[model samples]
Target: MELPVVHYSKSEYIETDTGNKVSRKSVICGSQNIVLGGKTILQTGSVIRGDLKRSGASNFVVVSAGRYCFLSQSCIIRPPCKAHKGAFNYFPVKIGDYVFIGESSIVQAAQIGSCVSIGKNCVIGKFTIIKDCVRIEDNTVIPPNSIIPPFSVYRGSPGKMVDELPESIREIYEARCKDRYTKFVPSVDA
Candidate 1:
């Protein structure tokens, strides 16, 4: 039997009942290696490259995102690469819950912990480890193999930790993520 082909509006994204709003235009490769936890929102033009598999390991996962993660417009999430014992290998990019990746940001980090806020046009270098509750300002360039400690505010080129994040903003960021998910509905043109 043939299934009916359903066409959606230009402004409409693929919204599941679990509140995961993924844009139809987004390119998500290597589905087997990519994991999207419930209530995740991948906005328009986002590119998630999970097809770049690990060396000599066909069954390894390339990318994973936890609940309420928002990948904004034109953002590119790629697996980190490294040289282990003179052999190049691609590592997984693991993202925790309540993460917001801003527009046109290129992330090649190995680990991005919970409640991380990355601003627009940021370039996160390969193998960078971002701990929980980190706030990265806009247009920052994080160096490779660097570690951002928890609750730190990072900014500028080569990304420096400017200040510490207040405990109060944690709740605010969480609520903002939830609210954005709820309001991230398709735009219906008149």
Candidate 2:
């Protein structure tokens, strides 16, 4: 898919050596524990809570994102937390390549597979696992501990599997994420 060129102010972004374009307005806590693979985009107002880690664990990664992932504006990517041994501990959040998380979405998922497109204002609850080639519709609310299978379209309050996706969705979704990344450019007037 070909996306229209979207211009952003050059001063508002920080392009890393590994080709990750992160908005300065985004709040990324505990960056040392957050691993963003090459060519990922962290848009304005997005929050990655890498600060939340397992209790008493050292040098643990809280959030890991793969290449060409796009986190839209105001989205929150936080690890799921649960009580363990009478103490609260946060788990890791793993996001695969070419995943696109839409605006205002709150993801507390344990894992999100590749080629997934999550729509705007959705709430992916804690410990949820989303498999590859999945599409989540806007305003959907997935319950905690849910496991979404591959090649499915999920929506609604409990985020049920509403439809099935084609096998070619992996290629199509990857192309869409690549196009979106390439089209998100900086304006000429810095």
Candidate 3:
């Protein structure tokens, strides 16, 4: 699916050499622990909390996103935390290519596979695992530790598998992600 072209203020975003466009208003903590593959877009007011790492002295990624990932406005992406040995420990968040998280979504999932489209105002609970080619509808709330299978559609609070996706869903999501990335441009008047 092709998305409409959206113009943004040139001064508000920074486009990197690897084709990653990050908004200046986005709050990304612990930059060293955050890895973004090429052609990823982090829109304004998005927050990536890479600062919360596991309770240990290991230098590793807290949030690793693949190519062409899109995090919409005001979205919060954080590492999932759990209590282990009477202490809190943060785990990594792995997002694959062509994943689109809609506006105002809070995602604390452990893993989100390729070609996943998450709609607006959703809450993906901590430790949730979403496999490839999945579509989560708007305002959905996935429970913690839930594993969403591949080629499925989930909706509503305590999101459940409402339908199965077509085999071509991966291709469709990949194209959509590419189209959105290409269409996101700086306004000429800016």
Candidate 4:
């Protein structure tokens, strides 16, 4: 199908139960079932797609922004599926409030919690639970079904818990979320 062209620039608030946001310079194909909350920024060169409707289930991608969330440049979020047919017949990706997904990352069948920071070029695997206040560094890969505890720093390939972040850093993270809420503006077109 030839999808309609959609573009957003200059920071507008958009809220929709199901739609795709294609940047003027980017493409988002087959993400018709995705839900983007108000003030969520879908930056340049990002592509988010899912086959939820094709597979006969509720495979929509949900991005809930309590205040604000940013899906940075060149990121891909798709449903988790295996090479074989019907492998990923059932799995969806869910991201929560105040999440910052950095550039060039692929997240599949993952549940990311509030206040999470996923660094650039990271690959979050299927069925993983990334809890709140977690900082995943750049170029890391999180294996499938791993439960990352809250308030931790995970790094390296196949990502391990490096350590508990300092309390001060936690405070800073909390403060950042607060700042986002304070500065958030619901999209005018919402």
Candidate 5:
């Protein structure tokens, strides 16, 4: 199926390549500092913010989206402070290919590998490294600077490696990505 060409308001500020699809409702603030790569799809209501650096420049929020990666509704991507002018400035948020970021999650200064699934309302802390094929459950909080070993299931507050998820559940989650939903706005009754 051919993807529809949507008119996004912050067009001048955003640099989108051909074949890369972003929903009209997805917002990219601090556009001067944000970059979206080819074939990436930033779904409805996702927000990308960049902080001010000490040099009076904007911090760079480098989002390297691998082919077929999908960032769902209301996902927040903020650059690390170390990557800015502050003492806490850190590196950019890098997401690998075929990764899925669930609704309403916050990903800051973290490295997410390919085929990983971050659930709804999850908070990925600064400088955290999530290895490939990891599955994080909904509402989980991953601490800063922590390492999540590859091919594991992490759940609960300050997420920890639980156990290998059942193959059935894993398959279900993976299949969910096939049906990506766009936002719907209801009309007012006059």
Candidate 6:
């Protein structure tokens, strides 16, 4: 049996030669400051706020995602902010390779390590650091400045560790992320 269509046609998303596909409908401010590694997918209606940079004279990246990463539809990926010594500034969001951010999630995270999977509608508060091989369940709310250790699953409103991921799942996660990138194609007909 053939697989049903999910993602919009490849045409709707601007596919770079390196396989980075960004939806036309997505709102990306300060495109120059955003760094996307090859084969990254930014789905429709996602908002990447690269415009919110740190307060300084030097040029700093606001949002940087590694290769084979996926940001789902309507998600908001913005830099985290905080007040330091009476001055407030936005910190960069660093996402490692093979990361998957679910739909409608608002991420104001400091770092998301490789093989991390975040479910839909979650709100990741500022300065949240998600370590490698972590899974966050849908609708979860992570408190600010929280650090998720590796190989764990966090769920619930005040996101708590529910379980640990098996070491075997690392390869599986990598394969799934890579597969999704390869299978995303534009629909022949609307």
Clashing pairs in model 1?
Answer: none
TM-score, each model?
Answer: 0.89, 0.98, 0.97, 0.72, 0.70, 0.94
Higher-scoring candidate on lDDT, 3 or 4: 3
Worst 10 residues of 1 by lDDT: 1-10
Please give, for residues 1-190, the per-residue lDDT of candidate 4 as tens digits: 2223334443442344432233555455555566665445566777676444335445454322333566778987776654446353545567776777889998874688877888999999877888877899999899988899998989999899997876566556556644544443433454
lDDT of 6 at 128: 93
Off by over 4 Å in 2: none
Model 5 whole-model lDDT (C-alpha atoms): 0.68
Clashing pairs in 6: 9-186, 9-187, 10-186
Kindly list the per-residue Cα lDDT of model 2 for residues 46-87, writing each as its tens digit: 999999998888899999999999999999999999997799
Question: Tens digits of per-residue lDDT for model 5 on 139-184?
Answer: 9999888888877899999898898855464345344443432211
lDDT of each: 0.88, 0.96, 0.96, 0.67, 0.68, 0.91
Ranking of models by lDDT: 2, 3, 6, 1, 5, 4
Which residue pairs does candidate 4 place in steric collision? 13-187
Tally clashes: model 3.
0
In angstroms, the error of model 3 at 127 is 0.6
Candidate 5 to truth, TM? 0.70
| Clash pairs (backbone) in predicted model 3 | none
Give a tens-digit lDDT track for model 6, residues 1-190. Answer: 2333365675678888888999999999989889999999898899999999888735677899999998999999999987889998888999999999999999999999999999999999999999999999999999999999999999999999999999987897888888888777777784
